[model samples]
Target chain A: MPPADHSYLTKKVISIGIVSELTGLSERQIRYYEERKLIFPDRTGKGTRKYSFTDVETLVHIANQMEEGVQTTELRRELKRQKSQEEVKRNMLRGQINAQFHKRH
Target chain B: MPPADHSYLTKKVISIGIVSELTGLSERQIRYYEERKLIFPDRTGKGTRKYSFTDVETLVHIANQMEEGVQTTELRRELKRQKSQEEVKRNMLRGQINAQFHKRH
Candidate 1:
């Protein structure tokens, strides 16, 4: 099983302003990407966007990809594929753990 | 002077349905692109979108760019740049024509 400390699955904790600076992309660009359903950021009670380390990484990656002329649709598909692959891995680990428990009994 | 028959600047005339099929993109995606101001199609009195050959080419170009990981913001910037360039060319042509008229007189 992957460590619980895996950064990508962690919750949002960084502000959008900081995210913009970190990603070196304009805030408008970030918001537009969100509007396009490219990236999902957590919102505060007051409707502020909170990002995570993973989100930062993802944004940077997206920026690089865009510079390379990649399209958003393909990026979205790649992200979905990564998420499903992670889910599969998690399920496989759980099945292995369950099998070990049954053997001990 | 360049021919005025440039396809890029032509008025919209193709239906959204035909544009979708020709571009191999879903109708929703084409609409979403419009919503994002990525592509503009002319509307009919019945609120139908009509695209021109340029719009079709732009959509296909966008799809290719997205596949290459390009962001919409970048694409928007590119489109804007192209427009300004054409505007500059038009102004230059008009200036040259005025100069010729004055010299002939």
Candidate 2:
């Protein structure tokens, strides 16, 4: 299967209000999460915050964990761990593809 | 190792002032957590709160979670889950002990 588009992960397509509705989190809570460095939504030229799909997904995950009494610092650590694991998998896949190409040549 | 004694877990031995100092939670926060039903400290006949070590530990845990932006309801659920798991383990252990005694007989 083709890899998912990275653009969709980053494209700021949702407003904060929509993000609140989708994530079941208050706008103030979203802003508080940003202040805690749990998420980073993009900013408009006028300084309004716009959220990407990634941001919305993160807020949802955070909400669930927060409900579980998980600490923000722990959540941040988990996020970093997940990102690192994904990077490692991506790198391993790239290396395998390169090796297969060389073998064919 | 023998199973840890449960008496120490429930024995109310500390004042709220000491709990506040030890747990690093304000007196008001401790009361609020009680109001939230997160911890149930014992009360004197005159109705002053007295904390067990377990209550102190739970407060510390709750404080950490609250810092992480965890919701109270979620924490309550987690607390209930932990209690249920402990009860299940205790029941299993009791069943094992009873089975061993019956086998010996």
lDDT of 2 by residue, A1-105 (tens): 654744635555456765776688999999998888899876766777867667877899999999999998998888789999999999999999999999999
Model 1 scores a C-alpha lDDT of 0.78
lDDT of 2: 0.80
Stretches off by above 4 angstroms in model 1 are A1-11, B1-105
TM-score of chain B of each: 0.83, 0.83
Query: B1-105 in candidate 2: lDDT tens per residue?
Result: 554644545555456765776678899999998998999876766787867666777898999999999988999999899999999999999999999999999
> Can you tell me the CAPRI class of model 2?
incorrect
Report DockQ per prediction, comma-separated: 0.01, 0.01
Docking class of 1: incorrect
